[model samples]
Target: MASSSAGIVTGLVAAAFVTIGVLAHQASVTAPADLGPAHATVSPAPGAVKAPRDRRHPDALPAGSGTGERVVYSVDDDRVWLVGPGNKVRHTFAVTPGSVDPAPGAYTVTSRSSRITGSDGVLVEHVVRFTSAGGVAVGFSAAVDDAAAKPDPDRPTGGIRESRADGDAMWEFATIGRPVVVVR
Candidate 1:
């Protein structure tokens, strides 16, 4: 009876390990290539009407942004807005800011990465690097598991996180050298 119980326990442990391995494998499958953010924008299905745009935040713009097209980021609100020609808002979304905030100024999107291990050791996607502060690159990314948990206060965090869907929109909207306006 003792030997049989031990065998059962061993089998259960093995099964748990196998289950963990399978989950890990699935999680490791990276997001699709960064064909710029347009790849994720899907058309409405048959017989389905498109949803109306959200004009709730009409005055969401900060005071310092340019009147021309640009990406506007509000450090106080931790929100980003992609402005189009004539100062039209193309897309807007909230973001998980880092421990450090970039000063209120104009910056350009310097680089982008489809996938990368964030400074916090998280597997991130849709990395859009905008500026460097205190030797750390500040950018936006989504976790592999699509988690948007707040950053750890103890760690030196520089990755401004967003949902996978939002990150995709940002990745598509902001390209290399795209203007970024930071406001308080």
Candidate 2:
């Protein structure tokens, strides 16, 4: 009887191991492919409407008091917006929320850069970096609560290198050198 019991236990342990191995194999077999590289050619479904225009602007006050703030920006649905005081809009151009995927939500501007000219005369423009606060939703049910610039430990630079880091994920955006004005 003792030998029989030991054999049963051994059989059960072996079965458990086999089951785990099968599950692992199945998981590996069913794993999805990385589709990021091939996503460029994919087009949106027919009749699917794009997201509404971003009307948000920076928080800067209008040039003249009581004149209703005028926001400068270029309209690009692909980018995010920072709504200024009196509903003035400022286009950050390239900076977008880290959580933006298939569908993105509103993001608030966390930092801004002053106008800077590049040595190439290309006019390296100012950038407005933003992070996801609450109430902003996006695709894949992901959201960002905070973001900051990536600090280079090797070289301590003065200007903040804009970056978005939500937990382990991070993203960066380049600023376009154009401004448009909108009155609220």
Candidate 3:
């Protein structure tokens, strides 16, 4: 009788473990809430995706301009796109444009400065210069204070302003002679 009781207890413990394992496996593969059969999202790891609404800029270029790894700037929309070698848009973000805009054509990164006072009298970093507009060096930068206000018209500047993090990405991506394509 004791042997039978022991056997029964062992069987129950095994069954409990099997049930727990199955439940954990199911949880790992469970699908997320669904709006409908046509639109259901899986529970992905954190930071795996950008919000659906923000996937692409509303006014973004349908296709990138330059070939190979390069930066594409849209003068009309005040947006910047970093294109990879395969012509994939690695990153896209908005930038505060300066008064002077670059011509709609191809240019190459000419110079870079880690930190400098912008022509607008604002300190900026990650300066990636490609061209000059009316003697003012045109480049991308992030304000030292990390402000995102529109360019100060009174400042009369052509310093394309971006967020500090975006500037960092631009700095790393656009070295000297990297192609910069400006489009209308």
Task: For residues 149-174, write the lDDT of model 2, one tens digit per residue.
Answer: 33243432222222222111212222
- The digit string of per-residue lDDT tens for model 3 on 1-184 reads 9999999999999999999999999768632222111111112223422222234657444452646788877766778988886777888899988877766556779999999998877889999998886667788999989987477666557788899999999999999988787765
Q: For model 1, how does the per-residue alpha-carbon lDDT over 1-184 read when each residue is reduced to its tens digit?
A: 9999999999999999999999999878652231111111111123522222236854466543666777887666778888998778888888888776665556678899999889888899989988877666877788988876577777766788889998999888889988776665
Per-model TM-score, in order, reads 0.66, 0.21, 0.66
Superposing every Cα of model 2 onto the true structure, what RMSD results?
16.3
lDDT agreement with native, every candidate: 0.72, 0.30, 0.74
Alpha carbon lDDT at 123, candidate 3:
84
Global Cα lDDT for candidate 2: 0.30
Per-prediction RMSD in angstroms? 17.7, 16.3, 19.0
> Which 10 successive residues of model 1 have the least lDDT summed?
35-44
Q: Give me the runs in candidate 3 sitting further than 4 Å from their true place.
A: 1-61
Candidate 3: the clashing residue pairs are none
Q: Tell me which of candidates 1 and 3 scores higher on lDDT.
A: 3
Q: Any idea what lDDT model 3 has?
A: 0.74
The residue ranges of model 1 lying beyond 4 angstroms of the native Cα positions read: 1-59
Q: CA lDDT of 56 in candidate 1?
A: 83
What are the clash counts of all predictions, listed in order?
1, 12, 0
